[model samples]
Target chain A: MDFQLSDDQRALRAGVRELLAGRFGRDRMRAALDAATGVDRALWRELGEAGFFALRLPEAEGGVGLGLPEAALLFEEAGRSLLPGPLIATHLVAGSVKGAARGEAVVAVLDAGQPVAHLGEADALLVLAPANAPRAPGGTLRDAAPVRDAAGPVRSADPFTPLWRVTDPVEAGEPLPGAGRLREEGALLAAAEQLGSAARTTEMAVQHAGAREQFGAPIGSFQAVKHLCAGMLVRAELARSAVYAAAVTADPVEIAGAKLLADDAAVRNARDCLQVHGGMGFTWESDVHLHLKRAWLRSGQWLTAAAAEEMLAGDLC
Target chain B: MDLAYTEEEQEFRARLRAWLAAVLPGLPAKPRPDDWPGRRAYDTAWQRMLYDAGYAGLHWPVDAGGRGATPTQHLIFLEETERAGAPYVGANFVGLLHAGPTIAAEGTAEQRARWLPPVLRGDEIWCQGFSEPEAGSDLAALRTRAVRDGDHYVVSGSKIWTSHAEVADWCELLVRTDPAAPRHRGISWLAMEMDAPGVTVRPLRTLAGSTEFAEMFLDEVRVPVSHRVGAENDGWRVTMVTLSFERGTAFVGEVVACRRTLAALAADARRNGRWDDPVLRRRLGRLNAEFRALWRLTQWNVSEAQRAGSGGVPGTGGSVFKLRYSHARQELYEAAAEVLGADSADLDREWVLDRLSSLSYTIAAGTSQIQRNIVAERILGLPKGR
Candidate 1:
């Protein structure tokens, strides 16, 4: 009945936080962002060893069989460190991926267009969404004119496209039932991602506000900064509650509600976090925009906020 | 994390529901018969019945003649009562909600014996005289003086917004005991008997066209020093206990009343023919979502309280719940008015009447601005600067 973490939960949180702090802390995240590079294979393997991606799987399958609440805690830690990878997608796939002997499988979801990996780079690309079956040239990604993305070098909003755009709009594989489609479960997943990113942004704001001084006082000591931080806290707390509640319920209506709440928090908090950092936050080096971009990406990852609300309205009928 | 109630809790709920079904008064419970004279009379009778049945003070202690129920049980009782359109507690809101709790925490053994048993018996009603004409939101600015005179405090001042002062037998009042120090530090919380000499009550007509509140004029009103709830110059702490009652576990009933309004709105929307309209549908849908969030919010708090075992005031969480509930209170009525259309204008239509009464929610209990300020300054730790 307590809303707080139990002693065991706290131990788990401490272990995960330490792991993330060592592997993907600000230094690692900054390096990766600055390099615009490939997956941190060593760190990813460590995470695998730690069973980060196997929390939800049954005990029979090399997993802890923890519920979504536990996964949610791990995911939040992942977000705080701003770890780079399709951690969410990988976890979602870990349950279903059978006979997996992998050279690092990074799962990413896409809508409208799939972001494929460099043809030689990824061992397997899990395509989230396939093009319309009614339309021709649908099963594979098409319309691929290689365009340099504003984000990292290899990551794609659409999981089918390689580091460079391919001729097809689909990833090169047999499409699953929900490659990049909206599902209540998937909606919650996307919302969780946003929740993670939003929480990071608030931390970014808080940390920066404490250290960065202006005129005479820490800008955080200023009332406006306090208000901004407070506002971010309010938004983040409510969104966290919504996401956590929905994740437990598995109700589509709650999922939509959580998605909307989390998306707003993530996007808005990221923006506010950036503003708190002033000019440095807007630059490429601060790693602030990375969170904002990730927030923007995951906000519409499974379904647009508008679409979620509309779907919720439909349920009301 | 699970939202389902325990089997025992559900059985408790069923038992309460069945009891309420058999015992609820046959007469109407709201709007028409429950408004003003008819309503007040019905409420008094019903509360007396509840006291006799040991259902009155669901949240009160066993020694105080209550059922010794958990917070969830208290919640379930209120939920069932509201669903049955049961009579509201007339003249006892202040007594049951604030005064009783304050006295229990800060009252002496003799004081508790003198005051609590009669109040629990529903033989007497109590009023709150905290708000002053000058000090509304700025409650600490109150100038109601309680000068110490031998064995008594000669209180000479006026109290505004004293609910049911003309009818209640006593008033749980806040008065200044020290003028030399700071404002709040100098105050003392007292129990003032309404029948004492040098006290006058004048009914103030409100927008509701009824004297729901009174202005009490005190001229050397003799309050025995023994009647003071706590230490001298520490009324602020005592009043804090009463205010906590409004925002903590006890506030569950009031919030349930709000959820009932939403449920009634939904039913009326379906029964009346407005269900098909897209605008109404969206409004109701949003309300439905908000209602679920609030239900979760309340349950979350209840769960924490249940887990805590020893009771205490909810700090920031209560503020969040109150703010959300107040916002939803207004929205529930607006959606109802749009559904009822022409009938929304009628005072007898409970929802419509509720639509009007809803304004008092944010204004009377705590202003929306005060809540925002509380969130701003305390809960959120945001600075409120010029």
Candidate 2:
């Protein structure tokens, strides 16, 4: 029983992290945040060209034909780089929707009851409607007619993620098969992303605690600060292990549990990271607040805490 | 990579499982038979049964009367044994796990011939005399002294937490042979007879109400210089060898046991009708996740060791595992206690005992604080504490 990644997986992870680091560093992230499009089109195209969205697509379908674990690893880098847009939605619909696999067309999903994020930028949307809802012409993106955009972008707490309330709801798109699988996949990848962010915040907290001194010593030397940093490490690692294992298992309940841990790690680490940075953390100049905001937004995305709670409760009982 | 055991490993596990199933029914059950002699008899009898099945000292070297199992096989032994809920390795632990390995690594030819077979056969129970009243985590700073008196060394000072001291026939002792040298420089490792003159053992009861440990007073107890395992004043290195064994694949049993314990905790919660409570269920789920992580982390550590082979740079990963395992186990039991509430007073003695005993996990090997320091300083390369 080996938990260590294969040599190929390690290389792939290193490649993805380096590529994301080069393309979506802090300055570029800030640029994306300030831009009207809210995403770097060039970088997005590069990701497609590099086969990011096509990772899990079958080799017969002209994709890299990797598994969910590899996809999880990629999203982890996305989370670490704080890459914006509707990532999980686009990734999930990539195989079914034309151009989505190639990353040429951005896709969004009406995420259950939540407002559809990145609606303004998405060329297509994947909606899972109830069995009683009005059916449309087709399920896949190939047959669905191009729908006109009727909603404008609404300001979101996470500037990187733009949201829009559907003013003119589309009643045409067919419901996708295995909505539960899609949610589980999304939750697993989101958990991976959360693990990345949690790990980054831990590093951030440790770095800040080392540099920020108060009483003739580094704050990290103090037990309280040391313990906080330690707690961050523990939470991040715990979530990482869970996320990685869930990716392997691909069980819905396991994924929900993984999401619960990842949510705790990401949210708590971000808050603790802000505390470690003091007043500077609250200002727009510091990126700590960006992480906290993103963590909050992501926690509510695929599997909200309450939803994950209920899923886990049902399983336990 | 793969979580399934190899075919060879599965066969080994199957065989061991069969052996355990065949013999375990005759073994004593919990509540541990209050009489001291009966308890000792039960423990030694179990060890003898294990020895007869060639299960004793399976991890030790082939030349030293062991099976010379691969690292993975050793882990399988631990896992299968624990899963079978076999008797605890109480009296023969030090002899089989620690002293035997140390003797193999450092003892002379004559020492191996004298000690190795007895340890493997459970003829001579062994206990560790490493910790002292003054030295626990800072073990190298122990002040127990052994001065030369002709062909024998007159040992003085005391050793605390000498587990199974009362029943053990021999002790793997560490003593300071030179007071003038630095703390770590003057120590020597010895194989001393527990019944040597001027030796006294007084058992110490822990919070769990078990005299699982004892303090031994040695006043001018004469031990032959020939009993020393390594060169004089080089016991620190020998102690390191023993400690390295402690940090090895022995953790497989404990990890499997922890998973079972967590499962039982979940069952208890469900039985008590608290599983429907979202908050409690969520905590249970989180605990389950943490346990899974620790399991994977252990596997990862084993894989890393395999990749590194013999001379790889030692990591602080053990400290990480220790910290996380203790935290998770403690939380699982504490959560059980909370969920049990007033019912804990009269119901489910196992939960009550486990909740109280779990606190010692953090404090036993190295306190959680010390583990964090190791992580921050050694692994993370943070500034050392003042």
Candidate 3:
């Protein structure tokens, strides 16, 4: 069984990396972060043109004929570049929502109990009922009425991702068919992003360790720093295997485990990466802290550690 | 990225499963851990069965008188065998996995003719004599000396951590042949007969109270120069050849066994009311993810080996796998102990024995600390530590 990425898949990932590097490089990302900008419409449309949102849509439906594995790879690149906005939500709704596949409309999904992300920039909103809530007879997606007045943007831990609290009781809307599947897919995608962050932070840590010197030698030559970098690689690689395997299997339990590991890897690797960077990692000018903050924010989104752990534990019993 | 096995690979698996099912029932009861002769006989008989069935050396090259199975087929072989409760390589481990392969790669034609067949046929057993008391992680610093005299090398000094030496027909011996040369450049590899005069094998008891390994002392042991695997003062490089084989799919069978152990632990927890504790359940759950990820990592490595056409050499990725799998194994047994509660202290229990043995995982093969150095310097391009 060939479980490694195919040449075509590698090309797809490289293509995404090239696209991101050219369009949303580090300088551009820093600029957006500093300016506190919302979703970039131009960049969003460009990603849509690249078939990012419609990656999993069937070719018969006039969309890119790909699978969740490919989607995971692309989102990994998104995560590596720290590309912001409601990327997963928009991509999840691309099959159902008009213009979403083409990136003309930005879709923001709201879980019943959770805050809405990118509520202001979203051209359309899809509200998902809480998993435990009762469902309507025939599940269907109803166009949600504008509830912008219900919430205002709140300060976000991740500067690139804005959050809003819904003060009013927004309608649960019709229960989307396969809501569970949607949530699992969302978790898997989020996990893929976390895998990307883990890997990126590992690279950042290794690069810094090799260049930064102390006590007449590169810090990397010290056992302490070398072990930290090595540990990051192990965690990232482990999470990567889980993420890719889950994408292929699409099993609920596997996805849950993948999320659990990916979340841990991303958050922990970022912290270790910061430690490797030493005092410079503490400064805002360095990208290390941003990764840590973003990882912290992402770890709590989609399927959280507690929720994923419970799901996995239930499987064991 | 297809995880599903090819039709041919599936057929291979089915055949192996059926063979295992048919043969396992007729096998003798397993020997006691302390019974070296019984273990040697039992393990070698199993190896003979595999040899007769053309299943021995499943991953060894065809030229080496093996089945020449692809990495995927080899993985399937391991998965099915471990699942069927078949015996491990055991006493033949050094012969089949280490010395035989190394001889195949670097041995002379006469060497292959004399040594390779017995190893594949289970007619001989081999033990590694590479690590000495003074040269554990720093293996090249071994003080084992072998002075050349005529056509024989008069060997001296001792080796530690040699498994199966008590019953081993041969020792894959590493000796310092040049006293004046550099540590790594002065070594040589030899096939020293265990029955040779002045060779000694003293069984060493592990923390698990098993005599699976021994301390081997070679005092003026005369080994023919023809027994050498490679050139004199080149044992270090010869040893490096075996390291590649060790890393790739070495833990594959162990991963399968660990998954089974984890399942049994969960079942035990459920029966004993330990499952009611959310903390324990979550701990087991996290371990479940860890092992699951490790299995996937194994697949990834095998796939990579297949792609690189390196004949199943998994490269530095093995270091990555070893670093985690070793610790994960320890963690798995620790979780088992937690589920066992007070019963964990009972020496008679299998879990207790396993938990004790698990302590060596991080320290054995290559210590976790050494593994990290390899990963950092090789995989991550970090500068080597002084």
Candidate lDDT scores, in order, read: 0.70, 0.78, 0.87
Which runs in model 1 stand beyond 4 Å of their true positions? A1-6, A98-103, A112-182, A199-228, A272-288, B25-38, B202-212, B245-283, B311-314, B334-353, B376-386
| TM-score per model over all chains | 0.84, 0.91, 0.97
In model 2, what are the clashing residue pairs, if there are any? none
lDDT of 3 by residue, B52-80 (tens): 99898888888888877887888888889
Give the per-residue lDDT digits (tens) of candidate 2, residues B292-371. 66776676666666656543235467777788888788888888876786877753467788787787889987788877
**Evaluation by DockQ, superior candidate among 1 and 2:** 2
Could you give the interface RMSD of candidate 2 in angstroms? 2.5
Model 1 error, position A240 (Å): 3.0
lDDT of 2 by residue, A139-249 (tens): 333122243255555678887778876655566454565443676788799998998899999888889888988888888887767777777787787687778878887
Worst 10 residues of 3 chain B by lDDT: B306-315
- Which candidate has the highest DockQ of all? 3
How does model 1 do on interface RMSD, in angstroms? 3.7
Residues A1-317, model 1: lDDT tens digits: 34445677678878998998888877777777656565667777788778777777678877878877677778777766667666665666665454121314554433444333443333334444422232232122221222223223555542222343333344355544333322455667767767877877877787787678787667776767766776676667667777777767777688777878778888899999999999998777787777777677667556566566555555554
